[model samples]
Target chain A: MATITRVGDPADPRVDDYRDLTTADRRPDRPGGRGLVIAEGVVVVRRLIESPYPVRSLLGVPRRLDELTDDLAALPVPAFSTSAETMAEVVGFHLNRGVLAVADRAAPPDVTALLRDARLVAVLEGVGDHENLGALFRNAAALGVDAVLLGPRCSDPLYRRSVRVSMGHVLRVPFAELPGPWPASMALLRAAGLRVAALTPAAGALPLASAGLAGERVALLLGAEGPGLTDEALDAADVRVRIPMAAGVDSLNVATAAAVAFYGLGCA
Target chain B: MATITRVGDPADPRVDDYRDLTTADRRPDRPGGRGLVIAEGVVVVRRLIESPYPVRSLLGVPRRLDELTDDLAALPVPAFSTSAETMAEVVGFHLNRGVLAVADRAAPPDVTALLRDARLVAVLEGVGDHENLGALFRNAAALGVDAVLLGPRCSDPLYRRSVRVSMGHVLRVPFAELPGPWPASMALLRAAGLRVAALTPAAGALPLASAGLAGERVALLLGAEGPGLTDEALDAADVRVRIPMAAGVDSLNVATAAAVAFYGLGCA
Candidate 1:
């Protein structure tokens, strides 16, 4: 069972990991950044407990902490109970969700290992927005996409904002950076028997519905919202598919477009 | 042609429509609310100019206004060019997109007229989040969803934030409130020769892939993210279709779910 501790002081050293959270270097690549995985709210905190990340501790209001009693009993970690006000002071913001969990980042799964037996996967290029990257992971998880392979210019999926936006699915969905040069690294997916299908809005590309990729192993390559896929990435794909959009309408948000692709391709 | 006016005063009464924008009564329904539609940034401002809504005027930095010169040249409205600092003073915030446009709301399209040739439509219930609603309209426009019918508990899509988030597509898509009672209001869709398909994540719901809704005239019923459709709303549907999500995962964002359904059934 987890130990329950009352932390009345906002400056308590026990809760130092939770200090100045809004300004902390949550970025994965910054110098001196610890890349601590922070999960906010009861839902995401519960997911953190179930995730492979090593749970550092949890700080939450009494009500929220009580709600997670069953899950807390199974884990051996300290649970800090505090008032909503002190919790706000410690976290540097008023988190309406009332519960938070912090964890250490875990090593990503090997690309080869993640690809073994994987059928539907997402290959992201230039998905730099944290929320978009996070929402894509949530979509990937729900739609049965086996894993996510981050290409160049993708944001860290474990960014605090991303973790919150994804509802902690970033913790559930295994993601690893695609190593080596940009488009060249995508060849590894082909070697693993997954067809590289790039998603573009270009009129010349085949419509997603008629791409004939259903029931076949596909790595749906997605780009950022405005600029879309880089030319090299589009050229690298074995097949280029478009979503068949209306004329004069701009492209869909990167994450929303990814969801549509994930569903159409995964169902096939 | 729009008359260009250089506004040197931050407190100019002529720009009252753009004053204290961050806290203004942008809500259309509230008393004392002018229900003025606000479009921010160069892109959305341009869209506002082209929309059915009557363009009131334009307030922008010289550069953003210069980009819209061609569009503005045909409009008979005042264009106020001001310094960025003065614009910030009037708007109560630093306007990053550097342009703002205000318009008077136009009458909604007649429901029966809108459904005449709309092969794919969205029927929303309780989609109170402005961003989700806006993103849904953006997706609807992109995926060729012909129209949207709002049911009970829906927010006003013409709200300023929705206009911006929709990438001004809300200005393009035709949406009107579904008249009559709550679930019973949905009957109007069937009478118009459209199938009422409610999207739920329940176990017994038919998987979207196998529901055979493609290419059929479908009015996809969507509820908000958390509670989803009410019992009456679900029963009122001609069919209950699910997006085939992985177990243990929560539902997709209502807008994203609607996009997947739109693509699946719209292309059918």
Candidate 2:
């Protein structure tokens, strides 16, 4: 059984990982910065417990801790119980979610290994917005895209805002940064037998439905919302496809577009 | 030609319509509440000018007003030019978009009239979240969805947040409230020779790709993110279809799900 300890003082050394979350979250080089993945709220905390990451501990209001008793029973990690006010003092802001869990990052699965037996995957380029990145993973997971390979300039999917917006789905989807040089590195997928289909709004591209991607071992390539894929990236793809859109309308938000593409090419 | 006037005072009665946007947007019953449609930023401001809604006036810093000079040249409306600092004081916040336009709410197009000759339409129920509702319109417009019929429990799409999130497409695509009763009112769509296809995650629903909705005159019914479609609504539909999703994953965001459906059933 996990030990439960009451922490009355915000300065308590044992609860140091829970301090000044707003600033600490930005200091990724610090203990809780990029070094640790932080999950807030009960739903996300549960996901952290089940994710590949190693759970450090949990801090929550007494009632919130009580709600996770069953999930904590098998783990021997420390669970800090505190009043809402004390919790807020340590967290820097009053978090209405009432609970939090922190964990260490785990080794990302190998690219070739993850691609093995995978029929559908998303290859992302320049998708630097955190929320958009997070929502993409959530959609990918829901639509059954096997894995995500980050090309160049993608943001950290584990950022707090991303984790929250994704409803903890960033923890569920498997993602790894693409190894080697940018566009040249894409040969890795082709070598692994996945066809690279770039998604664009360009008029010349085939409509997603007619592109004949749904039944294949497809790796959909996506770019940032505004400045879409670079010329080299588009040239590298086996085929280019687009969602047929009405004239004069701007492109859909990046993540929304990705979900549509995922569903279109997703396995039935 | 539009008349341009220089305004120096924040409390000037001429700009009262633009006051305290944060709370002012909520009191839809108040003078500027539901009575007016407010468009912020140059892009949306331009859309408001092009929309059927009658533009009453505009407030902007000198640079932004100058930018709108060509679009405003033909309209005989007041354009108040002020400094950014004074504009902020008047609006009760820093209006970073640098321009604002307010227009009177126009009469919603008749339901039967909007449905005429439109091959694809979306019939929404309980999609009350403004951002989701707005994004849905953006997707609908991009995918050539002809119109939207708001059923029960839906929030006002003209709400400021919705307008911003839709990137002003809510102003472009036509939407009208579904009149008469709840799901029973859907018969009008049937009368218009359109099939009512409800989207659900139920096991028995046909996969969207295999449902053969493409190229059909279909009104895709959507519910809120959680609770999904009501039983009465589902039972009333001509056919039930679902986007195939992976096991253990939660349902897709209501708006994202709609985009996929729109693209799938959209004209080639």
Candidate 3:
């Protein structure tokens, strides 16, 4: 069972992991910075406790902590109970969610093992916006995509804003950075018998429905909203497909487009 | 041609339409509120210029205005040029997009006329969040949804945030309130030779792909993310369809789900 500790002083060093969280979670590569995974709100905290990440501790008001009593019962970490005002002082902002949990990122799953029996996967390139990245994870999870592979220039899916925007699905979905150089690294997917299909709005690409990806092992390549997939990545894919779009309209948002393509791929 | 006038002071009354925009655009129903349609950034501003709404005027820095020279050449409204600092002072924020345009809300298209020749439409219920509403509009425009019918508890599509988030699609795609009482109003869509398909996450609903809606004229009924379509609305629909979702996951965001359904309807 977890231990509940009452915290009153905002300056107490015992709760340093929960202090100045805004800046503390910004750049994990910075000196004295640990890339800790943060989960806010009761629902997200429950997901964090259920995730593979190692739980450090939790900070929340009494009411929120009581709500998580079942989750905390199995958690071996300390749960800090504090007033909303003191909690806000430690976190550097007024958190409306009333509860927070921090965890250390676990080692990523082996790429070969993750792809062993996967049927549908998403390979993202240059999707740097945290919110978009997070939302993509949420869609992938709901749509039943097996895993996500982060290509070059993709933002950290574990970023705080991404975690929140993904509704904490970033914690649940399995993701890993694609190893080795650029497009060549994608060959690993082919070795595991998956066709790499790059999704683009280019005029010449095959339309999504007619691409015949349904029930096939596919790794859909997606890019950022504006620039889209690079020519190198496009050239590397086994096939290229596009969602038929209305004339004169800008392409759909990246995450939304991914959901459409994921559906067309028949992952669900 | 638009008349270019240089303004040095933030308090210039000529730009009153652009003053304290954050609060100014809040409630169109409030006293002294005009319910003006606002467009931000170069792309959205150009969309506003091309829309049916009557342009009041434009306020922008020289560089952003220069980019819109071709657009302004065809517009009759005055263009107010100001420094970035002055623009920020008037708008109550750092105007990073560098341009703003205000337009009066045009009368919504007649419901019968909007449904005429339309193959796909979205009917929204309780979608009060401006961003979700706006993103749905953008998705609707891209996925070739021809019109939107506002049912009830929906926010103003012309609200500034909705306009911005829709990428100005709200101005191009036709929409109107569904007339008559509650779910009974949906009879209009059936009268127009369209199927009323309610989108739900209920397990009993037919899965989207197997629903056989492709190439069919469909009026997809959507609702807010959390409390989805009311039972009354669901009971009234001719058929109920759902995007297949993974077990133990919440439903997709309303707009994303709409996009997937719109794609399934074969509108694009």
Best by lDDT: 3
Q: Please state the i-RMS of candidate 2.
A: 1.5
DockQ, per model, reads: 0.90, 0.78, 0.78
User: How large is the i-RMS for each model, in angstroms?
Assistant: 0.8, 1.5, 1.5
lDDT of 3 by residue, A48-167 (tens): 999999999999999999999999988999999999999999999999999999999899999999888999999999999999999999999999999999999999898788999899
Worst 10 residues of 1 chain A by lDDT: A23-32
Off by over 4 Å in 2: A30-34, B30-34
Error of 1 at A236 (Å): 1.2
lDDT by residue (B37-148, candidate 1, tens digit) is 8999988888888899999999999999999999998999999999999999998889789999999889899999998888888999999999999999999999998899
Give one digit per residue, the lDDT tens place, for model 3 in B144-251: 999999999999888899999999999988999999998999999999999999999999999887787777788999999999999999999999999999887889
DockQ of 3: 0.78
lDDT, each prediction = 0.90, 0.89, 0.92
Candidate 2 per-residue lDDT over residues B104-182, each given as its tens digit:
8888999999888889889999998999999999999898899999999998888888898888999999999989899
What TM-score should be assigned to candidate 2? 0.96
Screening candidate 1 with a backbone cut-off below 3 angstroms (N, C-alpha, C), the clashing residue pairs are A214-A268, A215-A268, B214-B268, B215-B268
Write candidate 2's Cα lDDT for A75-194 as tens digits. 889999998898999989899998999888888899999888888999999999988998899899898888999999998888788888888888998989989998999899998999
Model 3 misplacement above 4 A = none
Better-scoring candidate (TM-score), 1 or 2? 1
**Model 3, TM vs. native:** 0.98
